[model samples]
Target: MFHIGYIRVPRSTWSVGRRFYSSEIQKKTIGFIGLGQMGYPMAQNLHKATKSTHRFIIYDNNAGATTKFTSSNSDTKAVSTPRDVAAESDIVFTMLPASAHVRAVYEGSDGVLEGVTPGVVCVDCSTIDVRTARDVAKNVEAKQAVMLDAPVSGGTPAAQNGTLTFMVGAPQSQFEGVKEFLQKMGKNVFYCGENGTGQAAKICNNMMLGICMVGASETFNLGLRLGLEPELLNKILNTSSGRSWSTDTYHLVPGLNPNVPASKDYEGGFGVSLMAKDLGLAVSAATEVKSSVMLGSAAEQMYKIIAGTEGYEKKDFSVVFRWLGGEKIGKGKGK
Candidate 1:
C-alpha cells in the first residue's frame, strides 16, 4: 500500500497500464470539472486558495464557462476533457448537475476513469443518488484510486463566499486526508460514513428543505390572504416556532431578505427542477430503506408541478411561494 497524504491506497488494486510513480504522485496537481453556477465559484475559491502551491486544471462542457474561468484566474489551465484533467492531476473534484451527468463525466468515454492514475483522489461534490455514488466509487477503486462522495449544502451565495458545507462520505482515514483540501472551498466538512452516505445525507437534507419551503410558502400565502402584512408575518415566523432556514435565511417573501433569490425575482438560486430532482432522490432512498416520508413525497409532487409549469421550471425553488399565491403580497412578483 502507498499513501496519498493520509489515505493509504493498496497497490494490489492497480490495473494494467495505470501509472503509479512517486514523482507523478508528488506533483500536487488539482483538477475541477463542471463549471456551473455553484461549481464555478467553488472552483474559483479553491484556485485562489491554492494557486501558489498547486497547478490547477479545469474542464467544463460549456466553452464559454471555460473561457471565463481561465480568463479570470491566472495560472489556471482549461482542459478539453475530463480524461485530460485526470491524467494531469493528483486530485480531481467534480460538481456536475445530476446522476447521469456525474456518470458521464466519470465513466463515459474520455472520462475521468480513462486517465486516472493510481493513488489519485477523486472528490465528487454532486448531489446524485446513493446508488450512483457508490457505483462510481467502486469503479474508482477498481482503478486503484480513492473516491469520495462529498455533496455540499448552501446555495449560490455560500458557494461564492466559500462558506458551503460539505457532507463527505468515505472511510474515516480518507475523510481526514481530504478534509484540508475541502476546507479550501467550504467552511464545514463532515464525515457522513462509507461510500454513498454523503449523497444520502444531502438528499435527506434537501427533502426537509423542500418540505419546509412548501410549508412556509403555504403559511405565508394564508397569512397574506387573511389580511396580515408580509413584513409583520415574516417577523412573527422568524422569531416563532415556524422559523427554519427556509423562513429565516431564504424567506420566499421578496424584499424581506435583500440577499436571497426571493429579492432577485427568483432567477439564480437553486432551481425548481433541481429541488424536484433531489426530492425524487429522497423518495427513492426512503423506498429503498423501507422508511416513510409522506411529507417528502408530497413536496416532491409540488416541486414537480412548479418544475413542469412554463416559465417557472428554471426559477428558484422558493418560487413555490408565488406558485402557491403569495406573489401579490410582496413588491416583487414572480416572472
Candidate 2:
C-alpha cells in the first residue's frame, strides 16, 4: 500500500513491493553456478537481457543444463566447473536446493573461493537457513568477495515470466551493484539487510503460506464432503473475510480456483520436495530459536503424508489437500 502524507494512493500503483531502487552502479561479468529447474529459466532471462558482448557464463552439475544453454543461446558460455565460472565472473549467482548443498558448492574443490576475485559479488538465491547464509557470507568474505543471500518468491511460472520476487540480504553497496543482472530475472528485488535476512523472510513467509494452504484445503474438503458446492463455496470464501491466497489464488481443492495447479491436475509449480524441505527448515530454525511453530509443524506432517503417498513425484505441494482425503486429484501434470 502506497501513501503520500495523509492521502492513500490508488491501489493500482502497487508493483511488486521491492525496497531500494537505485540503478545499476556496478558493472559486472555475470555468472551462474547452479542451473536446475527454477534456475534454468532464470539464467536464460539474464542471458537474453545481458548484451551479447557481455556473455553470461553458466555452470551446472548436470551436463544437460550446459547443453540446454549452449543449444538455446550459442553465445552464452558454458563452464565445466563452479571454479571456472567463479574465476571468470565478477558476480556469481547460485540457485540450489539446500543449505548443505550451498556450503558444498562454495567450500568444495574448484569452488567459488578458488576463483572469486577480490571485490567480486556473490549472490546465493537458494532458500536456506539464516545462520548458514551468514556463515557462507563470512566464508566468501574471507576471499575478499561480497556475498548476498537473495532467495526468491513465486514459483516456476513467475521465474519464467520474470515476475519472481527476490528477498536480498546484503549491505547497500553490493545489493545495488547486482541490480542490472537481478532485474532481468525478477520483477522485484528487495534489499532486506545483512547476510541472511532474505532467507529468514522467505522461510517465515513460506511457513505461513504452507499453513494457509492446509487450512484452505481442509475447510473446502469438509464443505465439499458435506454436499456443499465447491464453486459456490469458493465464491463465498473469496469475497468474504475467509479469503486468502490459497482460497482465491491457488486453491488446492478442485473447482475452487481454476488458475491453480489443482484445477489442471497438480503439477510443477513449487515442487512437493521443495515445500517439505522448506517446512523442515522452518521447524529446524524454530527449534533453534525456541519458537513455537505449532502450525508449521502440523503443515510439515501434512506435506510428509502427501509425499509418502503415490502423489509424491507427480503433484505440487498443494496436493496435500487431496492426500488428506479431500478429493482424489486428477491425473497428469498441470499445464
Candidate 3:
C-alpha cells in the first residue's frame, strides 16, 4: 500500500514493485557518485566505517576529484560514468548538488537506471526539490528497483567525522533495508515517511535556518549599535528568550562563535548561494501548497542579495553578517 495525500492506495493501484529483502546486501558492491565538498568526505567515511572485505566504485564529473579520492582510497576505484558505477555495484548512493544534476545522472542513456538490475536499491542523499525526488523514485521503482530519498545534514565537518544526520524518505519496509548503509555514513537516521518526505524535511529545516540566522545577525547588530559589547550581548541572548541555534550555538557574529565560518572571514561552511537556493526551494514548496511562508520569502530575498555581493556567494552564509553591517563582505576588504 502507498499514501497519496491523506488517502491510502493499494500497491496494485501503482506500478511500484515489491520490496526485495536481500541478505547479500552486506557483501553487495557499493557505488558512490558526486564527490564534491560534502560528498567526498561522506564517501570517505563510508569506506572507513565499512569492512575491509567491502568493495567500492565511485564517480564524479570533476576528474580532479575522482583522481584525488582514488589516489588515497585503495579499496575504491573511480569509474567512467554513472552507468559504469551502477553496472558494477549492487547498491548505489548519490550525494549530488542540484535537481538538474540528479536528473541527468539518473535518467539519460548513460544514467544509473539504465545499468541497474532488478531489486537493486538506489539512495539519493542530495538536497533537491520534492517533485524531483518523487519522480526519480518512481522511475527507479518502474525498473523493479527500490529508491530512497535520504538527504543529510551537519555539513563538511560532521561528514568528515562520520556524525552527519540522514533524514530518510522511504516506505516502512525499505527502512531496514538501508539502515546499515545510512548508519555507516551518519550518526542519526530518521525515517520521514515515503518518497519525497526526506527532501521536504531538509527544505523546511534549512528554511528555518536561513530565517533564524538572518534574525540573529540583524538583532546582534542592533544590540551593538545600542552600545552592548559583542560578548555581553551574546551572553544575554544565550540566556534570554531570544536564544536559538543561531544565537546560542552557531552565532553569526565572528568573535561570538570562533568555531563557525564567520570567525574566519567566512571561508568554509555552507555557501551563501546554497542557502539562497534552499530558501528558494522553501518558497516554491510553499506556493505549491498555497501556504504562506512570509519570513521564508523575506529570508530568500536577503540571501539573494548576499549571493549577489562580490565573492560572497562562495563564502560562508554567515557573511550575511558582514553585509548586514554595511561592510565590504568580500575578499581584500576590512574585517
Give the alpha-carbon lDDT of every model.
0.88, 0.78, 0.82
Runs in model 2 deviating more than 4 A are 1-28, 254-259, 329-335
* lDDT (tens digit, per residue) of candidate 1 on 1-335: 64343344576854222322233334367899999999999999999987866789999999999999999886899999999999888789999999999999999999999989777889999999999999999999999788999999999999999999999998666777688788988899999899999998999899999999999999988887777788898889888888899888887888889999998989899999999999999999999999999999999999999999998989999999989868876533221
How do all the candidates rank in terms of TM-score, highest first? Answer: 1, 3, 2
lDDT of 3 at 2: 37
Given candidate 3, what's the lDDT at residue 215? 89
Measured with C-alpha atoms, the lDDT of residue 60 in candidate 1 is 98
2 or 3, which is superior by TM-score?
Answer: 3
Best by TM-score: 1
* RMSD values, in order shown: 4.5, 9.9, 6.7
Error of 3 at 278 (Å): 0.8
The alpha-carbon lDDT assigned to residue 301 of candidate 2 equals: 82
Clashes of each: 0, 0, 0
Give the TM-scores of the predictions, in the order they appear.
Answer: 0.91, 0.86, 0.88
